[model samples]
Target: MVVDDHPVVRDGVALLLRGEPSLVVVGAAESGRTALERAPGLRPDLVLLDLRLPDMLAPEVVAGLRTGCPQAKVVVFTAHGDHHGVQAALDAGAHGALLKDAAATDLVAALRRVLRGERVSDPRMVPGTAGNQAALARSGLTRREYEVLRLAAQGRTNPEIAESTGLARNTVKTYLQSALHKLGARNRVEAIGKASEAGLL
Candidate 1:
């Protein structure tokens, strides 16, 4: 089964898998609700899921799949590897998480590994990577804080960051402040510099 909100992505993945002699694309769903509802009947050995759906997040979907299809393995396929939702989904019992930009061969291999009972994560999404580790481990910045800081690095003001992220101006300010403190920077410029040096930009 493949679950993604985008028609192109969902169909594209299904088509790709169909070309594999050892794999079969049993079903495709455009939302988490649809996937959860159909998973039991489909009885797939593995589910390739996207992190963000219109109705639910990856963690919620992962939990549902775990309960509804305990025999099946769940792997998150997403573009936002840096999103906190990736870790949340893994923590909620996803067998693996792979970035959408991964090569087709790598994606297939990762899925196979998960089906064989191995836990996998994209190297870029791993906590030990410089940028990701700095934000998640060393600095302890949340996804929102990192996002706000990245925007600030791009010279975006608080209002711009808020508008882009759909967060309130004050909320954006708070995130920036939190990021600055975590990075041990006194201001946005210093924060940006430190983050850039740490490969967090």
Candidate 2:
């Protein structure tokens, strides 16, 4: 199954996959609600889902599909490079995620890998490879630290972050300090730049 808001994308994917002897284009949907409504009935082996559907968020759509069709594998197909969306979708039980710009061979390989009970994430989006891990270790920020940096990247002050996160001012400061140290940044601005480059913001 193909679930994307754009019909051209959907048609392109369906048409592309239809040429493969081992694959079938079972059903297509333009919104999360429609996908959920039709998924169980289609009983597709795999669903190539887009991150930005008109009716629902990516994580919510992933979770809904998991609940609605436990047997089907869900793979996120996104054009954006926001790691938050990728992380959220994975956390919500998506089998894998593929960038929209990925090659045709990579797309087929990702789908097959997911069907075989493997988890695949584009390295550019969620780098979990050895080199990426080494870099991450040098600046290994926790989820809380990432959250703080994300807010800081938007020019939020400690008090603003505290208020937004319901954390105390001192706690926000602590998180910011930790993040800065991990990213080898002496100040908030540098930290934001490093985090953005690392795809953590």
Each model's lDDT comes to: 0.84, 0.82
TM-score of 1: 0.77
Q: For each predicted model, how many residue pairs clash, with residues at least 3 apart or on different chains? A: 0, 0
Report the lDDT tens digits of candidate 1 across residue range 72-188. Answer: 899999887656678889889998889898888888888889988998899876332544654466668886788778778778888877766668899998998889988899998
The candidate maximizing TM-score is 1
- What's the CA error at residue 57 for candidate 2, in Å? 0.8
Clashing pairs in 1: none
